[model samples]
Target chain A: MIRNEKKWLEARLEEWVGERLIAGDQAEAIRVYQGEKPERQWLSFFGLLVGVGALSVGIGTILVVSYNWERIPPVLRQLGFLLALAGVAEGMARSAGNRIAGPALGVIWVLLPLAGIGLWGQVYQLSGDAFTPLAVTLMLALPVVWIGRHASAAAAHALVFVWTIFVGVLEPGSWISMRGADALRTSWLAVVAVVLWAAMLHQTRRLSGPAVTLLLWMAFLVFMFTIAGNWTGFDIRHEGIHFVVAGALTMIFWVGEGVLGLSGRRVADVGWFATACFLYVLSFFHHGVGIGGGLETAGLYYAAVLSVAGVVCLARADMDEVAGAGGPHVARVLLALPWILSALLLGGDRHEAVGYLANFVLVVFCLYTMHSAVLRADRRRVNAAVFVLGLLMLTRIMDYFGSLLTSGSAFLVLGFLFLAMAYGLNRGRRHVLEQVERGGEA
Target chain B: MSGKWLRLTLVAQIIFFVAWAGVEEYGRANAVEFLLETRPVDPRDLLSGHYMTLRYTSLDPEGSVEGVRAAVRLEFEKEVTVDGRTWPVWHAVEKVEPGRVGDRSLSSTGGWADATVTGSRLDFGIDRFYFSEARKEELNSLRGGSFYVLATLGGDGTLRVKDLVWDREPPTP
Candidate 1:
């Protein structure tokens, strides 16, 4: 059973015992029959240890090959790698029913192809970009990932797959060159394509949970960096259109969760968190600080299409149904507000106004997240909201006292304020959680 | 996945690696050898470790070639002694139409190389020559010296680097 189902059953058992609908012993029996919480913790630790060991051995082998040991003949090195690969494959095949050994061997099995390719390049003195070998390795490893169905191997495959896409996109004279505004736009489009591909893989169950999670997290970090880049004056030419694309991408997770049923509650939570972060970062931009290049007609058209699609998706995704609460309509409004306001303010050349509007909307959204998290007893979301609040406080404090006090004094004051705020927030969080637990018991 | 299917996939993977290595080995064995004068552009690839980036003197654009794609026909100039090994040096003759190099007259059958014209430079894609880290300092000292790459031109227009000879000194194997 899924974790949610298990938690629901446990909660029901507690309520039944509280109401005397079932005895405490019966409740304990049901809990015991549930098989000790799936043993995921032990498995996760074991997987980590195995993953680290595999990585060390793989890197050591690659380094040995890279050393270009002149004493060993090239043919001998090639033969050794091929034999190692065969041995690993044989082990993986034989350990079919052993969970720990099977996945561990599968990790080695998937990595050997890349190492072999690297050795091949080394032995042949083949001089080319890393993209070719990486692409080839991913192709060769796909079958292993599919047939082995090992999460660790799948995670390794996903990492290399994402790396290959990045290398292909960013490498000079490949699919796209990493120069100028056009390159930036194309790179963002590639990221969007990969994220959509991952979602498709998840929907089809071809990618396991860990692999999909890693892909999504990497994509999220990339998105955050892009937004942070714009805020720091990297100056992407079509500023308005960039915002639209980002907003549309953020809306995709919500669409996946509500409309397509391709993602789960974690994905929806990510969507909300990303939207909050997108607005929070955009609030830092000052007037006349962005790209001054005239907007291209093609960019405007792209922006228009994206805006329409984003609106349609948001409208189709019932916020309350997806959030399992009543206040998510406010979240939906907050989501659309950025795209609309960005177009208006940026088109009017009132870029500073965007900062003001984003600040307001972000504060309101953080409060909403905090309230909703407390109601649902979601410590993660509550922590996220508190962190955002702390960031806001720091930004304001820096802005107000940056030039007024001496540098050392300002840092000292900031340090004390941070400690005090953290202490208060921790106590408040603990009190709220205690109340939640008491309510549950009662 | 069942053990039977797992075995099948593993076997397929082994076959793929073998075939890949075999094809590369065959290409190297059958390819025609020639030397091209080159200069070091950079060193090292992040993934593959230490290496040298080479730009072929014959394929340099020199602000003459126009358009995005250009095919350059090569003609063997003369035999030169590099590191006590005699290798035929090839130079670019003239720009010819793509896939029509054979019809145009050429001094020697050193094969043609396709290059991507980016601004005033052409990327022949056979530019990198990977070497061991022990030879890095030795190769770095010959950056501005005479450098010739002993390469093979495959029948299908693929060029592969076989060795790097610097200032008529044999490179470490």
Candidate 2:
């Protein structure tokens, strides 16, 4: 345990730093590391790709068969395969990054990026929902970021992100049903969102920013649809203004980066982080006061402005000395006071703000926070908080949509589809391993 | 496996388990799934707790009907085929044998009705089984027919639907 480092425990890191440091023949060292043949490791990568591909197929079959997708278009099935392949490619690419597949990065990159982009364009085009705008931005940005990290994984992550976005956001309508008054009370979407939050936390989870952006947009879709029809609908009149303002601020952040010569991705990162926070705090404020003050109020506007500013600063610079572990935790702090006041001030009074539009926005804000929190990984409370919020939203959705919906059958089918997938995935993996072991012994 | 590897796998397993368990438990406890099924009931007679929902075998895409007339004609090329249309599902034809499929039924939830079905062709059930009484009536008019439609176990473990049937079949008595 003490020997985890190369030298003694008390060895000066600076004293040995130069040995591996780039002082001597940096070019030759790069060349040698790059030149080493990675054929053996290539075989291991192929094995991983095979495992993931087979598992995905086996799992997909169980779901499609159990659901009887006689009516589902084949294009969707093709879309699913594209996603699975991307995941496999990402794993292979990550392996390649450690100098594993010497020359084959050439071959892998060619096939992987093409498949990845093709899938991305198709899936995004297929849905074209409110969330589509957000997902497309992230998907396009990711492969570039992945290429920076490792070309293969980036391609794969980008590809997988596209499909997950398509599946989670675009396809098969949401089972979420919430009354106008209790829209934030509890909805099935909230439940699924919470579960997804938890699942992300427990896995060695990574959020391809685009993937999280897509999901956040998905949560936001409920609001978009709720007040979608009329100019006077609660979401359109109230929260939509705020989202537009946030979008403007995001664009400003983009413009600022171009003008001031600042970082692009970080600017985008901070903008997303800030938008999520503003939504979080707004949820609390509206929750406290059934009907919040208009955007004309200086105090609310100042807080909003500062929240965006703080995230921008944090995203641009290392905020470790100032805020430590950065945007998510700070966002939580800013939101905590309002949440407390909301509960204490409102108690359990049932009222209407043009039918609880304000509260629904807050619900969306909280869901977004939980999503961002999972990506940042250290903040565990946000995950729990979102799950509870989701449970609450389910009640509202069912109450509102219950009368309007055909039956609870859609929700039931969704429930079964997920259950079967989980059961099948685990079983299928074990079965594959057993077959492998028997073959190895042979 | 290494300790780290085992821990990671265990965590994944826990996450997957919790997700499925949440969906299943929530569905059963809340009757969320039951509320989602397609329940057929007359709009005039429909209410939350009243009226057994009816689903027709002739209407369902995947159904198996037993003991019908042998030569009951087949037409597969049209969409939205229901009663009283010029080419309705069943007319005055030589009675034929049963078909190989049965229409499945589930409980209904409230909403504006989308489409309407008129005149019965073939219906299936266990206790509510009517072998063509050659009479027709509105489903809601049946006495004591107001009840929540629920699933029941047949002789085997397969599903059996029991509710109300408004139209009478001819071969009964």
Every model's DockQ: 0.30, 0.04
Model 1 Cα lDDT, one tens digit per residue, B110-172: 666666655456666676777775566676666345788888776655668888876744444
State the lDDT of candidate 2 residue by residue for A237-290, as single tens digits. Answer: 233333433333442343245553445544444444444444444433433344
TM-scores for the candidates: 0.57, 0.25
Model 2 scores a C-alpha lDDT of: 0.36
Interface RMSD of each: 3.5, 18.7
Q: What lDDT tens digits, residue by residue, belong to model 1 across residues A268-340?
A: 5666766776787677765345634556545566556767887888877756532423566766777677666
Per-prediction RMSD in angstroms?
11.1, 22.0
> Of the candidates shown, which would achieve the greatest lDDT relative to the real structure?
1
* Candidate 1 RMSD to the real structure: 11.1
Question: Can you tell me which runs of candidate 1 are displaced by over 4 Å?
Answer: A1-23, A26-72, A95-115, A127-138, A149-244, A262-264, A269-294, A304-442, B60-72, B78-87, B98-124, B137-143, B168-173
lDDT of 1 at A128: 58
Single out the weakest 10-residue window by summed lDDT for candidate 1 chain A: A175-184
Docking class of 2: incorrect
